[model samples]
Target chain A: MTNLTLALDAMGGDHGPHITVPATLQALRLSSFLHIILVGNEAEITPYLSQIETSVRSRIEILHTTEVVSMSDRPVHALRNRKQSSMRLAIELVRDGKADACLSAGNTGALMAMSKVLLKTLPGIDRPALVSCLPAVNKTPVYLLDLGANVSCCSETLFQFAVMGSVLCEAVDKNPSPKVALLNVGIEEIKGNDQVQQAGQLLQQSPQLNYVGFIEGNDLFSGNVDVIVCDGFVGNITLKTSEGIARLLVHQLEKGLQQGFFVRLMAKLIAPRINSVLNQMNPDHYNGASLIGLRGIVVKSHGSADESAYLQAINLAVTEAQRRLPQMIEERLESILLDINS
Target chain B: MTNLTLALDAMGGDHGPHITVPATLQALRLSSFLHIILVGNEAEITPYLSQIETSVRSRIEILHTTEVVSMSDRPVHALRNRKQSSMRLAIELVRDGKADACLSAGNTGALMAMSKVLLKTLPGIDRPALVSCLPAVNKTPVYLLDLGANVSCCSETLFQFAVMGSVLCEAVDKNPSPKVALLNVGIEEIKGNDQVQQAGQLLQQSPQLNYVGFIEGNDLFSGNVDVIVCDGFVGNITLKTSEGIARLLVHQLEKGLQQGFFVRLMAKLIAPRINSVLNQMNPDHYNGASLIGLRGIVVKSHGSADESAYLQAINLAVTEAQRRLPQMIEERLESILLDINS
Candidate 1:
């Protein structure tokens, strides 16, 4: 029941509104005052809207558009060329302040390209980096920045990401001066190339962070630290890899349970326990990643998101906007970029 | 008994000989022909060997080496200084033709560094890569090269890895022309950097390779391709992240199965099934990464390897030696490098 209204990409995602619509209803049931802006062709969202008409019928607002950003759409061409696309228009609502944030279960590259140009990176913010909220041993998530936004990064950009990631932890998890680590081959001080090595030193020097030394890829989920900083290329691979492996493990478990009647019975007996375990490790629990240091909030869902994933994103956006993290980051890092310029 | 003996670094790995010893014994029990050249101090190995006074023990040679390479030891410094070190001595066996291949569950950096300087990269190979055999949906591992060897890579190096990986796949799996893929963030033909894009073009243009187009991180386990190529930095991150997430998955599963008496009973009933599933996805199965395209056979195991992991390394080295993969790769890629160089 917050003041923020979220634009949900209704026609987007692999499952479209089937999962998205149901997940939306679930979020509405959880919230008292969330005004939803459903952005897709009216005909497509109308049926699902009618289905969830009880809890959200009065609170919801529809922003109809016909253009669909296919998974394989040319990113730059899609944003510029597909002018009236749902993904683009939905983001425009955020730009126009008609909605606080735009959540999409659509093509990632398109969303990033569109959001960056629309919401724009905040002052002194190099780019709108994608942060990944990874489930850690603690109830809190491990915030990893630049998860495939800027593939190529300099030492300074990575350093900036560390700062942004730390601030994000503060905003979302109520952690101030969150522990930060640069992704590297080794945990030692002298590990990695000039970029990561220099970034390591810079994060350490930046008093705004609780800079721990380099963390390897294996340390990401080990509850070793709070924030992990990396270039988009490495981050993307890490995020997708973790997700894919988790999926594989589940698949392997299912395959095991199907081998015999004994295993099937065992699975049935422990189904509740298994469900609780999955609930804890569920990707949805740590779903939304805020585009930290953006002039405005932009939360990207998994390109294959169901309604649950989109709902997580909306909550993330609302949280980020409430914190006003962009202003804080600008205030802190303004001197560095300007000092370099001067 | 097998005609070939393999040198094993007894002091290496997290679980030491407890796991390593059992795993080695497992491999020995399975393989009627493995003569393990136990490389460690006489005092350290004598007790273990004395317990195994079978006929096979007579064939086992205990090489009493004075020095053991600490995981923290500088690679080049250790190789140049510690001539009597276990890892160094292990490689020396391959150099002196005492063992067909050498496997070590010691410091990875030390192994690779020592291996490269001692064993040397194949002619035209700029650097030797630590290629991990990634478990795919196809039930076989896809060879991923440069998994944290040389971080920054040029086009020539990636192309060389593609050749080296293909050769390894052929020799190890007996697949003549393995599907080669360059790991990029996207799946388009022109999706990556100048280096990857150029390599992708070259891979396509080359008649020798079964060159597939670019693959994203998700495709690694998708069974869409056989070999994945990348710079060491990205490869290392991918490998480590995959392991980290896999470990998390096991922990979650174990915790969930132990929630209550009912759950525990179910878990006990399904213990055999779970173990079978775990055995299939066991990291030990893909334990050893051959420093492919090197002049001599050098296998690198994880620094924290268990007995099963070490044993797997021993088995891998034996198989590579049996197939003469290094020799085959040298013959195949040597001319290609020369072609590129010329």
Candidate 2:
């Protein structure tokens, strides 16, 4: 197979090129059939480019741009003024067929806006949903969608998210028929608002998807469903709350271990085991979030992600590029439309 | 001060009289000026009543009824058929002014429904939100409301929740002017749905509330705000997600500690510290959920709560009863309404 190219927004996030460049090099070392185009200012990229090993420098390219998107820039403002920004240029590479996929740790709203306007949504997709894989109790990853893309979604939009989320699990996780569930306050059909109830009905009626009815927030880690769908408002709150609770527990555990001499000595003795558990619960391990339903693949990494975390984002983009995710979603959507029409 | 009386639905929870009776006895021992009316089947309450010490038995009285509300019963069904149920009768005690407050471990939906119909809402309050206190990093409990009452709330309804939640912290937590925040996906005013954005504006405009603008789910435990107000769907999901993640981390920690011989031995040595941390994070310690914004005080305990947890619920009820919470909220609401009218 030929090497897949990924466009990295090197001038994005807090540390910008300093973090992205090193993460790209690390990803390149691990994956032989991978190439990265670092997009940022020429001066900033040159220093990082020089640090890469001469032997492996051939696989690393630089796409220099003068403009940059600030963290506080609004979506509308960024779209209007950041035409030549590094984030925009990286996304443009995918639109112009120069790169297989685009990965950014920049402003999420701006990235989504630029990606939508540049690559456009798939043929049958009205809006792109922010989807991500979360670690679950079943030792498998569960796909949750509309994290913060469309805060208030209608029934049709939610149904579209479910379809896209299901396809993501099937294409990426090899789950032929992923069970999709709607996140609600209760499992009963009578629960939630009109939008969720209508969406649940549509999901149940869909012949192509495995709809498993309604589920609550606790079900996210229950490992009972493959795809959990909800409006962006609820989805974002659930995701962030899970992240916050995870951090709180780790902080409390460390505090507990530092109480006295006896506990401190015991903590040192079992440090390796405790560290392993913490590593598995680390949010950095699951850094990348997929901007699904777009014309081309785009993965958003956390702004504070370190080397390993950023590398995971690049690897996620590579995997999606190799799977031809956009084409697969388009095909699936076309068949569903045909089924409804017929 | 006069002894405050509380109505206890002894047959409500999973363990029935087994957990409720013991919990009531413990609460009686703790509060000398507290009286409880245990409502349940006579046959089931008699054996537990006999087990109680003769001295404390005077403060614990039984109100026997044959009907009971099951956990699986729907709210509408429980309201329509279980009219004479122990849960309903307990709420009736409060309605008739025989008991200062009511504490039940029955179905949440049923409890809310019956309480709404029996106790009704305070004047100027459109809807009664489900309010509860969550442990925060500041070692103080932050009051959050609309847990699962009104699923789809408009802008005005959200503002009402802010008012109710703020008053809850003031009356319960004794914060003179609590800082109130609207739970949103982002801190920016332009973020979240139309409802949340409009609610933020309304909350900011209200001179009665010390509105602190928008807060995300991560801020729930940050202990930065005194009260967090959100629609029922988002609030319920956030609370449950936090609970789920807490359980997941504890499970992971225990599993990690038991893996090796050295780690297991070390775990035993530091078990006391670990237990203390776990106990602080235990949901059982914060078991009671207050049904705020009603004309009377009604506390809902988890159906699966054990003896200690049930005792906490009874104690919470006792505290609220002595505080005259309903009258305090009424006065605050009336003053706010006067401010609006004047």
Best-matching candidate per DockQ: 2
Q: Comparing to the true complex, what docking class would candidate 2 get?
A: medium
Error of 2 at B76 (Å): 3.1
| Top of the candidates by lDDT | 2
The TM-score between candidate 1 and the true structure equals 0.89
Give TM-scores for every candidate, taking all chains together and pairing residue i with residue i.
Answer: 0.89, 0.96
Model 2's interface RMSD: 1.3
Cα error of candidate 1 at position B339, Å: 9.0
Q: DockQ for each of the predicted structures, in order?
A: 0.62, 0.72
Error of 1 at B335 (Å): 6.6
Tens digits of per-residue lDDT, candidate 1, B30-118, equal 77777788787778666665577486666677787778888777777777787888888888888888888888877777888888887
> lDDT tens string, model 2, B1-342?
688899999898889999998888888888788888998898998887766676699888888899998877888999999999999999999999999999998888899999999999998888888888764444888888889988989998898888888888887778999999999999986798889999988776678889999988767888889899899999888887777777777778888898878889999989889877876776655788889888999999988899998988887887788788888888988887677668
Q: Given the true complex, what DockQ would model 2 score?
A: 0.72
Clashing pairs in 1: A1-A33, A19-A307, A20-A307, B1-B33, B2-B33, B19-B307, B20-B307
Off by over 4 Å in 2: A135-138, A337-342, B135-138, B340-342
Model 1 lDDT vs. the true structure? 0.77
